[model samples]
Target chain A: MSRTFYCRGQTGQQLLLGAYGALCRQVGLGRVKMFPRTEMLDLVVAGGRARGIVTRNLVTGIVEAHTADAVVLAAGGYANVFFLSTNARGANATSIWRSYRRGAGFANPCFIQVHPTCIPRSGDFQAKLTLISEALRNDGRVWVPKRRGDTRSPDAVPENERDYFLERMYPGYGNLAPRDLASRAAKRVCDHGCGVGPGGRGVYLDLTAAVAGLGEKVLCERYGNLFEIYERISGENPLHTPMRIYPAPHYTMGGLWVDYGLQSTIPGLFVLGEANFSDHGANRLGASALMQGLADGYFIIPYTLGEYFGGAALGEVSPSDRPFVEAAKEVEDRLARILAVQGKRTVDSFHRKLGAILWEHCGIIRNAAGLGAAVEKIRLLRAEFWENVLVPGDAADLNQELEKAGRVADYLELGELMCRDALAREESCGCHFREEFQTACGEALRDDRRFGHVAVWEHAEQEREPVRHVEPLTFETIIPAERSYK
Target chain B: MKFTLFIWRQRNRGDRGRFVKYELNDADPGMSFLEMLDFLNQRLIERGEEPVAFEHDCREGICGCCGMVVNGFPHGPEKGTTVCQLYLRHFQEGAHIHIEPWRSRVFPVIKDLVVDRSVLDRMMRAGGFISVPTGSAPEANTVPVPKEAAEVAMDAAACIGCGACVAACPNGAAALFVSARLGHLGLLPQGQPERERRAKAMIRRMDREGFGACGNHRECEAVCPKRISIRFIARANRDFLKAFFVHPGKA
Candidate 1:
């Protein structure tokens, strides 16, 4: 009766609900209750199995323990921990990793995906920028000012003066150089002052020609919403003008290490959807996140859980077992400590600081010195955060502030692991680009010899560094080679 | 360029919301409507006033998050566009723009402009997916669907679920959303096993959710953020009719 399913809102919840409904219908069970944005502190470990979960309900200010035969963690990935993210509010990488680290689970805290095409920087106060999908690159063209010092308006610039670099470099894929390559190329151009937009941080994604040639109806059929989004963000009509876009940290392809059964190293503890590092190896393809999330929830978890539960004698063992009760108390204690702090710095303040370091150092083009500096800075910030940080409201009620503090607390620790992961992996591959590993053509040079394996970090005691476990990636279909856009 | 905006300001669904005007000077023609609102918000923040709240995500038009009535159109003056992508260039300098949230019974206005579209999610929950239990990753090619069918399914899958079609329709019908789901599942072999039951269950759930019946205004197709075709609606109707006879008990 106490089996708890913890998942993110919107897509993840829908997937789980659908699966739950199907399973309940098939097995003749009672109705299922859904909780949104709740935090799981730890798994109740009794007899070496995940007996239940100790969780805090974010909506109503109650700290209740749910003892279940099993706990499903589908809370999503840590893209929100980065200074600039394409993710929503709850997905702070550091906090989620720390929560698992507190328990017995492997957190691959470093596998973040920086989406190549997002609306470029608009202002400093902008918390999170919007993403324009890579699918647009299929038909749309990416261009920048040919002249190094040119700062002309998109309309003012002549066609000859604009450099269609993606088209020039890759005759076949053109603007579609997968997400990673396209993003790097855009960054390279912008770094060279060919960047468009007000901050000079983005390039122009021109579809004027496409619109004119395809006619409004055909073009509208394809990219109508994108056009609307562009207008909403940039305040310009794309029917006549080109859109300004750049890359931002969108999705995290990495997370808690899960096996084929979607179970992490911990027994009776399962991770699904974006929370588990299952699908989308290094960089995720467009429209794949939804597919992967639904796939895990609807198609993957139900089958796997049945096998797990069958071994546990179905509903014979409930979460109310002793291990679950003990774990629930520990979670309550952790929440009490957070509320006890009552410090000064807001959660947003700490998160913003953490995000800035990650974005500047561990983001896009990272170097060893930058990564090292990031770790030192993050450690200093963590010290200040724990001491001076403030939670504005009580944990009860619809407290967004309390929820943010909890998520950010994890980000602080997770940020350190990200820098460490970046530091450990010296080779440039996929979204993880190190300045040290580039060819003469300025393309990423993958050092497959030492860095091809997935770095799964085992949680160590506080103040002690975590141990690294490498899961060797064996490519079956696609050969690992220099990813050439040209 | 300077322009005036007439925006709908509603506290909640029950309250009668009206148009509020604001002026913007030195605005770029290329800036999106949301960006203009962002600019307006920046000014409001400086003045220590609360800014207008609106819903949006995945500016690429894939997430089905943002939608609004702009200048009497679901997206804006520009046909087939979402509110996020409509730029100011379409408007004449000094012209007035009207902005409002999608009007429908199912989508109750939550704040100034945001509406609770969880009704659509509820409908999907009724029976939007196949009865495949989660386990191993099936080879994508395991189903052996024809390339043409897959492409058709992919087209239907492009629906972002922004609810623009419902907003645009005079009847407040969710035919576009329903049709997109129907089309996606109907064409695929993976969806074959539960086709009739799914059709009946989804329609019954849609009716249960208090969404108005489709009136064939075709406005849903016109304002769809994805420009999802009306053909899907036809396909849905055909499937529903077939399911009604084939699985009468489910209906």
Candidate 2:
């Protein structure tokens, strides 16, 4: 597996470069027209099918209509809704949410993957978090102070007293365990005051033995960029300091719900990559995110799209068509509304406050009471957001504030639905851990009879009132059992 | 902890940018440079003013979408740091910082502090690739690359396409970015078949895009966020020269 997939620490980048290179090649050959920095604003639906889109040329600030036979959304994830996430800064849920408003279903959105090993958030000013890839766990052993709130240097913490918790609990997998399992273990220990670092929410991922076994140069060859990123962020070299890591919102498994062929609830509207909730039920496995993205783009979309095109192309529509104009007007009107407010609070201020609520209630741990409470709070926040979001700039130009306000507006709505979904599920499974549904031994207890179904949510006008349609899970071969890392 | 920042401000692509000073009273020292901008932007909204626009994504420095000239240095004062990772801790208590966008004719200003980087993508479009069709490639281990060669390829592959090299270069050259891509693919066995063709096509495209030739000024490596060395430029020089002599003679 190491030789087959690992392209050092840059596998994702390498694969993307290959794909981007191919796309760029098509652009150069005049085979595929590339809109360099255009961002999608809304979907144009006609005759109960998605026919085109409204896009803003980010450079020129021109909103244009692009009528197409199909609208494919590979527009990343919603992890950025969590202020301190390991997603690209521009990655947002606006595109998916717009499609949802145009009548698409969002599925399992509460199943957000929290990474076990991320550079701990330094302060309130952090724009985005960096992920120390799980591959480093192949050599590094995770540990913390056996005694809670120990302040001594790591060198002084004796080996006998040190709690290598991952190694202690799961002898076989240890630090190399799956993402959700590792994140839960770290959180569990931290909850007990055994966590290290400034906020006492971090555990040490030590690499002493790894450096000894495989020379520093070898590791440098493989993970030099990651190590450098760590040092730059934390101001501590991993060669000496055990990396202080805490769980962070890395990926969101839930997205616009799609069928087996990768078509969304809307006809002619396709979804892929992290945008579509297709593969990796509940939690994703290591190396699978990139695999899924590449597979969807190269294999699945081509075949499925070909099949769709074989049926019929959309009716002839121009930029001034009724559907295109209506979609364009909808986008322009929203932007105008955001600008007209001229209210007190910034979009980010409201966003930060909303993030704290969701993180405290719906994040990591959830319960009926907490989830229900979060939904109510989200409603108030959403109301305040529209009334006082303070989107300063007008819609006449390229306003960064306008763009963010729109994304945050969508997040405020999506946040409520996520909590409602969490509240609906009575059983704990995968990354969706409801506190009331846990077993006596502290493992996630699944209720296969009642809760074994995908809760597909249709967006309703009012917050906390999304209509849910259940798609029950049917296991073909593997039987459901306890997940015992021990 | 507060400071005065002279940020570059432009209303639109056509608007001429100028330094607009603002007093940033609120901040956390731990925030990355972009986070500092986020703080300032939040304040700008409170003041009923438009926030300065800058290009950024994947603030962890992987995407190469973010760039700025800070205090006369590309990506701030820190070495091997993108503007996104440059923390406030590196600055003094009351530092008066000058922030500007990348200065290049080819990469024109789109808005305040944001430039059109479509040219770099165009350079990549010219040739930066292996010609293998999807799903037709053999087993990964089929091509046995020596460890040293693989390591070198990884080192060269670390370029994020950030265009810092072009911004920092006195001649506004994109040689470093092109060389890094060239070095990454040209060293590997899989990239050998189209090495000559790749070199010619990419070089021609860079010239056509109006990027200046490499003037051997090492400012590119000095200000590069990824700290990619200029050795790849030397490698690209060799590839281009060899391709020159061989292209017409081959047929």
**Chain B TM per candidate, please?**
0.94, 0.97
Candidate 2 lDDT over A215-325, as tens digits, reads 899878667777888887888888777899999898888999898778999999999999988787787777688888878987899899988888866677788888899
The 10-residue segment of model 1 chain A with minimum total lDDT is A1-10
Query: Which prediction has the highest lDDT against the true structure?
Result: 2
Interface Cα RMSD per model, in Å? Answer: 6.5, 1.5
Q: Give stretches of model 1 more than 4 Å off.
A: A1-42, A56-58, A88-99, A103-108, A125-127, A133-143, A154-178, A205-232, A235-243, A278-346, A386-393, A437-453, A469-486, B1-251
Question: What is candidate 2's DockQ?
Answer: 0.71
- Native-to-model Cα distance after best TM-score fit, residue A263 in candidate 1, in Å: 3.2
Model 2 ranges with Cα > 4 A deviation? A1-8, A209-222, A462-464, B25-27, B249-251
Scored by lDDT, model 2 comes in at 0.84
Per-structure clash totals for the candidates: 40, 1
| DockQ, all candidates in order | 0.13, 0.71
